[model samples]
Target: MGNTQIGHTDFMSKVRLTDRYVASVSPPPGGRIEIFDDNPLGAGLILRVSQTGRKSWVVRYRNEDGEQRRFSLGLYPDVSLAEARKRCIQARLAASDGVDPAGAKRRRISERRSRIIKTFNDLSLVYFAASECGEWKPRGKRKRPSTISGEKWLWTKHIKPSLGALPLEDVTPLDIKNLLRGLVDKGQDTSANRVRAQIRQMFNYAILEAEVATANPVARVPMMGEETPRDRVLRDEEIRLVWRALGDPGSLTSAQGARRANQRVYVSRPVALAIKLLLLTLQRRHEVAGMLRTELDLDQAIWAIPGSRTKNGRTTFVPLSPGAVVLIREAIRLADAGRDHPSAFVFPARWDRDKALTPASLTRALRDVSKALFLPSLTPHDLRRTAASHMASERLGISPLVIGRILNHTSEKGGAAAVTLSTYALHDFMPEKRSALIRWDKLLSEIVSTRL
Candidate 1:
């Protein structure tokens, strides 16, 4: 090993490169210099020192074609002398095997960059943005806001904590199975299924659109459990119990008529009115929870729900019964009383005046009430089912078609009937929906007023 001068201003020193020697070397005053490693393990490793005091490790090698090439190992301090030697040895071996190490490094970096979504969290952000921008709509229909909101809630509460940080390619079917298993163990079987479906769709999107994931891990994973269609129609006594619990906190007592001292449940007046409206109108929980002031016409007794908010992506005009109108007005009054300025939502969140009462909050409220009343587990959606069930009873004999219209259910029939109903039928069914709701209101009034 000897010293050699390449140019007038630059020189090369042949030295045994070590941590101590590399750290002791100083930069040249005018130009850069390369210190070649004399140690056998260093191979073609050299430490480049620039006039600005920057030091980096570079490995010089010859390709299969005998062309000279220089590949950077890394910067000094960040990449130690021993590590640089190790990388220098590997690079020299790769060059000896006729592979261009620099090109290979570039390809690896390019592939990583092509995988724009690195983690599940990154995939979720891109997926949600694409869905919002109409990139992933099925049959040219955008996802409903409530559906998106629910999915976001699920992601934040359940999915994100478990899988958000996991690399997209590393999420195995077993990971998804274990995630679903955890939910199932917590008695969230339906939620587990929903989470499974969401994960499946996300991975499908990753494969189809992002091109980052080669396969869907959730494709092989089965549903957590068999989800039976819920038919728990509330009996009249149960309905009365729910009504009393919503209206009177004192009525929320155990089956033995004893109020749990530690678990006194209180329903806010606006939430109570919203729950009452849910039963009276037979609308979805999110629909009732997100009732907007602009959607309601108290004079015309109509609630025109826009397509953006409805589950079926159709604007529905719900004919409000007198009872429904009364509930809405009461909720509005309470909302106004609680806020300095009028809120756009009929049922504004207790903490945030600008935002509507979330469907999750409604669910929680019903959960508390159910626990206090010692009632079988009841969701707010169950209230809608109770009304629809009662309307279709033998006593009322309300036509299923009318009930369907009142519920704003999409026509599920096929062929000419479906074609006519979906394509040709311009009838809003307002009159029929109104009549059915009025009859339901009358029946509900009786059920609530009757002493059990």
Candidate 2:
């Protein structure tokens, strides 16, 4: 009988690996073949052939714990014999240094996944939630929806597109500066400044609250450019023109009064009246636009602006003049007309009627009125300044302190004085403000009565 092998096991003598010898080897039936490499760098390297004739390179070593373990480097031909030898030496060296090679590889993979998950886009969302809940401010007052809306737009338009994908720690000031410079080069210096402020605020929140960033990337960057203060107070004639443009039918621009009214985005009558309230109250455009009918006390001639509505996040009670009262009543009439009950917003949006007027709509209306009357472009904020200037003049004899209260100018006086006024002197100065507003109303009446 022929000499026969009882099993498929074949053990080969150690030899230096070669491409030709590796290609000629085959596994015995129903068993694997083991071939050891003689090279010193591959002292533990073995060519493993399965019962199905599959080939792979593996390394066996005693770990620091004195436990035997096997690590697969790669398949033969795919790994190449020379590359397998290099990896086997590295693995042995790691085992000698008390490192678990398999555990180390897993740790590296985990760190890469962590970097992907901790990107700026992720951090910004966390920052936004904190800001929306009022955690970002010293007073802990919730931000207005419009203010938060602007921040979201800024992130979406500018921040998210440039650096959102990068990990938070990876963002550098140079990245921020380059973005700001691009905006400045396009004649958007003011916009760049605003974006810088918003981004800096977000980064600061990340550092202090989220603890995701070690430093604020934008903290060192200066504001893009000096913003020129606008001192464009309206003159008497311009005031008359504005009033007429809002009130008089003939004063409507050709585009506003024409047929196909739906196509034209002219200011509705209620919005015009809202502008009248702006001039009368000297309130910010957003404050007036977001007014609720419930906040007004027509009988008491007072409009109470809640703390959240004001820029300083303090509740303000504005005394309404007799003239202002009349305008408000007319606004109510317009709002309540053709409705079941009084609308929630004093200045309901023209499109929705249930919601308050948008800051954008108020701005657009003022723009149209300015264009229609051929007056210098003016804003609702200019009206606020004009009211303060007139009230503080010697002609009116209204004290600066009273004017400050009426305007809610807490930051007008800095340092100890501002702190004292805000903290200890919580008095509303209601009667003084009322007298000052009455005086202002008389002067405004005389100014608007003139037909220019």
Candidate 3:
């Protein structure tokens, strides 16, 4: 080869390229210089050193049309001397095969840029947005906001830290297994299972809707732990303890007396009222947490939860007991007092009144106070179960069917009975539900009133 000059300077030199030689070369003062690699392995490779001291690898070749073209291999030190040579040989072979290597390189880059979801995080955003818009639900159905919120929480807390930055196609079953195993090892077996389910659903969404992933990595992965149906029912004594810990009116009076003697109230008033309402009404945590002022008619003692907010996509009318009514009134007062404007939700979030209190926040509050109270470790759902169990006991003598109605549970029965209940039984059972909850309130009053 011959030296090529540009801009009144010799800008080309021929040499056998080595890592040591490339590192020792200094940048030109004015114009860029190209160091041609004379080694047979890197016949058309050139090390382009600009006047700004930046170094990069370039491959010069002639296509089938006898057209000279240059393609950038990558920056030096990052794409090292040996890697540059390997890429140069590949580029030359492509050129000799009557292919325009520069065009091919540009096509590959353009294809990559055209992909909307490059990483797991990108895929998750698309999945969540689609879910919120009801695109993922069955015909005429919608996804629950709480379900979306819980999935997002799982992604942000558990999955995102491990796989969010990974390319969509790069997440393997082994990576998913390791993540679940880590959670299982920490004794979070249920959480591990939940994480696994969320990840599997996300990848399925990607495959069906986004067309990003070809296969679900979580498909072959087994469940990390056994999840039994939870049948936890807090005993009457435990219920009393929890009710007191929640700072009910009786508990608050005592807390205030303690505060006069320098004691602190750990439970917030709004959350306490919400939890009490959960036990009194036997409603789902999310449904109660997202209770809107418009959904209630205090005069008629009815709380009409819309189909949009429910799990089974059926509207439910819950009869609020006298106690539940009082609690709702107090929560509304607190909600109005906490913000500059009136909140639409009965249980408004503490930080942002425009939104309702999150179901996760309700769970967290119960978890923390339960631990502090040294009571049996229980969840908010356990409180609902406790109420249903006691109402079914010989003391209250409420039937399972009535309790199920109060809980707004969809009928799992099949055949004619299912059709009868689902299609014909259009009655809201307001009267029956009201009587059951009133009996429950009477029994609960006696239970919480007893001296522990």
Task: Put down candidate 3 lDDT per residue, 38-65, tens digits, no spaces.
Answer: 8999998999988888999999999998
Candidate 1 residue spans exceeding 4 A from truth: 1-116, 250-261, 338-340, 413-428, 450-452
Q: Write the per-residue lDDT of candidate 2 for residues 243-361, one digit (tens) a residue.
A: 77777634455344456332433677777877888888888888888888888998999899998788888988898999888888888888888989777987787678878887767
Worst 10 residues of 1 by lDDT: 253-262
lDDT of each: 0.84, 0.79, 0.84
* Model 2 residue 334 distance off true place after TM-score fit, in angstroms: 2.9
Q: What's the TM-score of each model vs. the native?
A: 0.70, 0.63, 0.70
Model 2 has an lDDT value of 0.79
TM-score of 3: 0.70
Cα lDDT of model 1 by residue, 321-364, tens digit: 98898888888888888456899999988888888888887787
Tell me model 3's lDDT, rounded to 2 decimals.
0.84
